[model samples]
Each structure stands twice: as C-alpha cells, then as structure tokens.
Target: MRLVAPQFQPRTVSAFAIAVFLALTAFANPAGATSPSQTPPRASVMTVATQDRVDTRISGLHTRLQITAAQEELWQKVARVMRDNAGTMDSLRQARASNVNSMSAVDDLKSYGQIADAHADGIRKLTPAFQALYDSMSDVQKKNADLIFQTDHRHSAKKG
Candidate 1:
C-alpha cells in the first residue's frame, strides 16, 4: 500500500476522479460488512494452574478477533482475581491436606465443597476488580475473553 501510495500521490488533479471511482467500486457490493442484526457468539478465557505459578495464562479462546491491549488488560485482571483468592484457597488446601490423611470418606467430600465455597467467596470479593477488568478491555477482547474464561472458570488454587 505504501509503495503504491507514492506513485498515486503525483496525480493531484486526477486524484478526485480516481477517489470517486474507487468509492463507487467499493460501495458497489461490500463483502466484508457485517449485518447489524446478527448477534455474535459469547466466549471466555481459561486459566490452567501450573506448578508454582501465579499468573493465569489465557487458553481455550474460540474467537480470533481480539485487540492486544484488551487481552493484556484481561490477563492482568484474571491474575489479580486469582491472586486475591490465593490466600484463602491456600488455607482451604492446607485444611484439606491436614484432614485428608486422617479423615474418613464423606468428610473429605464435604470439606472440598467448603474449600470451593471459600475460593468462590474470594472471587466474589474481587468482583469489583473483575468488573473493572472487563470494562477496561477493548470490545473485541471482552468478546473473546468471555469464551476463554468459561472453559474452566475454576482454576482451582488447590492443586494441593
């Protein structure tokens, strides 16, 4: 495009004619324009917890259309949410750890839910952060990030 621009630049008088022709040709039958009534699908971002890691790397995104700045911001928000819950999640893990070895079967199951609830509570507490993060994203990132996040909303801190 740049190389061709210089060659076209010298044709000052003919530029108007060329512009009108191009405009008309472009408007003749637009192939790329999306219909206004068509609704796009929803998506999310996923985080898989790896060994000794805090930052959540995005995974399982279905949409290719996203902006870089929005993606970066989404990553930051996801990281913050996970980090906020880290302490509580870790505590639950420790509790489960201490009891798992000694406890009977049903108690283990019960404790797991409690731990999950605690983790969810942590997430709920960080709701403001999540909302801010979502709001900050470019529209494209938000759309794709939705699909990615839905993959496994529970990146359970308890790999314990």
Candidate 2:
C-alpha cells in the first residue's frame, strides 16, 4: 500500500519552496567568506515567472532593507534572480515527486546530482545581482543584509 499522497497542491509546493529558501539562506554561507570570483552572466537572461511563494520572500527582503526609490532597480534585479532560482527548484521538486518511486538507485543519484547542479547554477546566477545590490546598499542596509545571509550555528552541539 502507498503511504504517501499522489499529487501536491500549489500551496504545498509554495511551502516547500519557502522551506528550501530558508535553508539555503541559513546555510549557504560560512563565516562571511568571499563570494566566487566569477560573476553570473548578464541579469537579463535569468528571469523567470515570479511565483507568489518566492514573491513573499522578495517582499520580506524589501521591507527589511528599507530599499530607497533609487535602489529599487538593483533590488528588482536581485529579486528576479531569486524568483528564477525558486521557480527552478520548485519545478525540480515537483518532477521528483512522481518519478522518485520508479527511479533506480543509480538513476536516483543522478537525478539528485542534477538537482544539486541546478541549485548551484541558480546560486551562480543569483550572486552577481545580489552583489550589485549590496554595493548600492546603505550602511544600515548592509548590516541587515549581512545578518540575513549569515548563519550562526554555535549552539547546535559541538563535535570535538
């Protein structure tokens, strides 16, 4: 007997997307390290449909950053990259929902690798836009962005 449900609603997809986003934001960086030397390709190519799930994230960042009218352009660029990343990830998760049961072990590994690659590529596409926005941010905004992106896991149990 099947233990899991068959179809995922849009709401479920959105919740999963947001969860992934939070995980990414919380764990992607360590110790304020420098970003990659290569910048992503021009911002024009990475645009995707702005899903409501991802839009909410962008809205939160906008409010937190206190983005000025002049900074709106850079903010939009970064938000576009974020939306594109989230859309790509959500699509991958949905695709896996059905096929995962049938996939052979090797095929499952390969599929997971592809998903990881997609996530890495999305980060690649996202960084330059974020960097540009970071450059334009005010001192207060920079502090806020730093806190938002950096994750401190000191209390999570040390393994010596």
The number of the candidate with the highest lDDT is 2
Clashing pairs in 1: 43-146, 43-147, 44-145, 44-146, 44-147, 44-148, 44-149, 45-148, 45-149, 46-148
* Candidate 1 ranges beyond 4 A from true positions: 1-51, 56-78, 150-160
lDDT of 1 by residue, 1-160 (tens): 3324223232342322332222122112122111222221111121233212333122212133243564566546654555445534444444444445565555655564454455445545555655665577677766665544432232221221
- Provide the global lDDT of candidate 2 against the true structure: 0.55
List residue ranges in candidate 2 displaced over 4 A: 1-50, 151-160
Question: Which pairs of residues collide in candidate 2?
Answer: none
lDDT of 2 by residue, 1-160 (tens): 8456354343444322433346343322221111122122332332233255467667877897788999999989987777666655555554555466566666665665655666667767776787798889888888876655432221111210
> Model 2 shows how many backbone clashes?
0
lDDT of 2 at 15: 29
| TM-score for each of the candidates | 0.45, 0.64
